[model samples]
Target: MKPELISFKLCPFVQRSVIVLEEKGIDYDITYINLKEPPQWFKTISPLGKVPLLKVGNAVLFESAVIMEYLDEVNPPSLHPTDPLRKAHNRAWVEFASTLFFCQFNMVMAKEQEACDSAEQELRDKLTQVEQQVEGPLFNGEVFSLVDAAYAPLFMRIAFLEKWHPMGLLDQTPKLQRWSEALLKRESVKNSVVEDLEQLYRDHISASNGFGASRFGNA
Candidate 1:
């Protein structure tokens, strides 16, 4: 049976999962979710009420990182390194990207600019660490790996936010900046990025004049 992915068009988490599937050349069905009112059954399957859920036969997977790992296992793309230590390094970076880097950025996006500045600084520190740690094309060099897949969307968003906010996050992290620019040039990353929704959100927030404007206005 074919797999199905339930996701939100603009979600970075969902985008990561889709990039993995696309890179692996796996065929799957895509279901776009409404963040305002998701389906009742989706909650049961996802538990956390978040998107980027995958249904493969009787198994269901949530969390973009886990879902990507499963896809990697099933499809066996050359994305993961053959060396056990290198594979661990790849996984380590993915965890850092998802939990540390992405979480900090999300916090910044969810709050007012003043409240978000500190968090944005924290994000920059994390990105700086990433820059120091990773080297060569992709996180593990030349070949794109799970680390790149997990962090690419967040990296892309950092670039976008920098354009508008002028935060010095990317300025201090030259390696990460180079990696992001290179990764985004890939067809999978290009196709997976939800530019329309990203732009819509940006416009929505800008028109509101603040985070509350976007939230309350949407409400």
Candidate 2:
């Protein structure tokens, strides 16, 4: 059965899985929901009340990382490293990428400059760690693994964020910069999000009316 992914367009989690689905050429369906006012059916199926719920026949899976891993496993030619230790390492880094996504969101929604500054520093620090891990031109070199699929959504958001305001988040991490460039250029990553994702981000930032919104709201 073709899996159906419940998602919110603004969700990076959904985008992560979407990239995997796209990369694997999986035939699936995606249902977009407003997370702020989620539907009754969604509330019933989702335990944590999150997006990117993978409904595969009778079984339902939540969590983007889990969904991505499941897709990789079910599909032929796994995206993870063949070595046991290396696969585990990639999984750990994918978890780290999740933290970085939250940090970037916090920075964007920060109502005060102090909060934004702190979030920026924390994000940059985390990105520096990711930089050291990059084997380039992708996360684990030429082959795009699950970890690469995981980080692509974050980089896509950062690209938009950088366009609005040049924070140089990738400046200190030349390797990540190169990695980000590669992921952003990939067909799967580009096709993962909605066509108007950037405009949606702009509207979202303006609506936020926070420190970040004030600076890039007009942009």
Candidate 3:
């Protein structure tokens, strides 16, 4: 069955699944929806009323992590560490990526400079923690895995956020910055998002008119 991804165009979580699909050479259909004014059908079907939903046959899978794991398993040569303990560690970090996303959103939504600074510091601290775990080339050495897919969207968004705001989030950590660059250059990561994703992301922050908006407005 060809999987159909229900997504909000700007959702980083949804982009994670898209990266895995592209990396695995999985042929899938994608349908974009307006998150601000979700359709009635989406409202009725989505248990959490959120995107990154995978529609496979009649089974609807919610949550990006679940969807990515399912896709990896059904496809061959799972994108996870073969070592049991290492795989669990990777999964934990995959969950860690969620906190980073929340922090990124908080930074973007901060209405005051102090609030934005605090949010940025929180994000930076978490990133520093992530820096220590990274093995190099990819999340777990040279081989790419689902853990990499999970965090690519965060790096992608950070790149865009930094472009407009110059927060230098990754600057302090050489290893993390290298990992981010390597991931960004990967064809799968590069093709994971929409063509005008930067503009769309900028528009999102611009619409918010938060502390982030003031920084990105001129760019």
Candidate 4:
């Protein structure tokens, strides 16, 4: 039986696991849930009531990182590197990448220009830290690792924001910019989620009238 993934449409964490699954050619079933109104069963299974819960038979796995690790362990072409030290290093960076998601969330929800500016600076700083460590084409040189999966969704959102808003977030970071462009064009990264994701993000910016929407400024 195919494993089941509980997801939210715009959740980057969920996207990470989905990208890994697609990359490994895993057959899986995914169902999007309303985060605000997650079912009772979901609540019972997820201690934190978050998306990206993986159900394998009667076993349930929470947390996107954990789910991805499990999938990689069970599937072929292991997404994580073979060297123990390198794998640990990649894992640490994956955690670092996760922090950027929160930075992005705060940035997206920022209503005022000042708040927005601060959030952007925070995100840029975090990305810069990742940039210094990136040896791309993929996160760990030529081989795509879990680190690549972790950062793909972040790049996805940034790509959309850049096109619609022109934030110049990646202007000074050539390595990350090239890395992101590579991820954006990847087959697994491209097909990991709903086909209308970009449009959905645009609609969200317009509807929320948040910092991302303001950046467009009638353009």
Candidate 5:
């Protein structure tokens, strides 16, 4: 049976797993569901009632990082290093990427400018740490590891946010800035979501009337 991925169109977590699947050249079916009103079947399969659920054979997987690791192990040409320590090191960076996403989420949900400012500065500080540790063109050099998959969405959202406001998160991190630009061009990153993702994101933030969206109004 072909693998199936349950996803929400705008979800970055879902996109992380999608990029892995695409990079592996795996033939899988994807089902996009409304997260707001998830169907009973989705609720039944997803332990956390979250997306990027992978149905492989009889097994179901939750959590994007877990799913990415599973896919890497099951498939050939592993995205992670072979050495145990190296793999663990990459995994640590993957966790860091998750933290960055959480910070980005907080920034997006911030209703007040002061809250958004705090979240944005926090995210910038975290990115600076990543910038200090960055290896190069990709997270782990030329090889695109799970770290890259995890971070692609963060940069994608930043790309959207940059259109509405000035985000100098990369001003001091030229290497990270280049990495973001490179990830944005990857086919998997570009194809992971519905077309017009920027528009959808803008709509979502505008609907919330968050600080990011409010900038456009004040401008």
Candidate 6:
């Protein structure tokens, strides 16, 4: 039986899973969940109550990064590089993109503009380090690998954020800017991203007079 993916439309984390599924050419059932009313079963499987949960028979997976790795292991069109050093470099950037960059990006999403500004400065400093570590098209050199897979969604979200805020967040890191542009151009990335949902989100927030705790209801 094919796997089932439970995901939110606007979530970049969920988009990561979709990218892996497309890259692996896996046919699966996609169930869109209302972010305001996630199914009870989803919490049981994910434990963290997060979207982008994947279920295949008896196996269940959570966390977009872990889920993508699992899918890559079972499916074709490997997202990770075979070379040991390249693989390590990929993993490093993936980690930085998630833990470092996304954390800061989330602050902006959460409506902490001042905090976001500070976080963006800190993230820019970190991206300088990342820029020094990478030299070519993908973090692994010529091929798109797990790192690209992992970082793509974050970059997409950043691009969306840039559309509204234009904080010059990616300005200092030319490597990341190039990487993001290339990744966003991929069919897998393009198809996985829900641009409509992003626009809707922007509209919703605009209607609410900007995001606040009351707007999302204690999320």
lDDT of each: 0.75, 0.92, 0.91, 0.87, 0.86, 0.73
Give the alpha carbon lDDT tens digit for every residue of 1-219 in model 2. Answer: 999999899889899999999999999999999998999999999999998899999999999999999999999899999999999999999999989988988888889999989999999999988888889999899999999999998998899888988988898899999999999999999999999999987888789988978866664
Error of model 3, residue 49, in angstroms = 0.6
The TM-score measured for candidate 1 stands at 0.87
Q: Give TM-scores for every candidate, taking all chains together and pairing residue i with residue i.
A: 0.87, 0.98, 0.97, 0.94, 0.95, 0.84
TM-score between model 3 and native: 0.97
Tens-digit lDDT track of model 6 for 110-168: 46556545666677777678778766676767786777777788777677666766667
Each prediction's Cα RMSD?
3.2, 0.9, 1.0, 1.7, 1.6, 3.7
Comparing 4 with 5 on TM-score, the higher-scoring candidate is 5
Which candidate order results from sorting by lDDT in descending order? 2, 3, 4, 5, 1, 6
lDDT tens string, model 1, 100-121? Answer: 6555545445558565556666
**Higher TM-score: candidate 3 or 5?**
3
Model 1 scores worst on lDDT over the 10 consecutive residues at 210-219
Q: Candidate 4 on 127-190: residue-level lDDT in tens? A: 8888898987778888888899999999999887777777888888899999999998999999
Better of 3 and 5 by lDDT: 3
- Which stretches in model 3 have alpha-carbon errors above 4 Å? none
- Residue 114 displacement (Å), model 4: 1.3
Q: Compute the lDDT of residue 175 as modeled in candidate 3.
A: 83
In model 5, the number of clashes is: 0
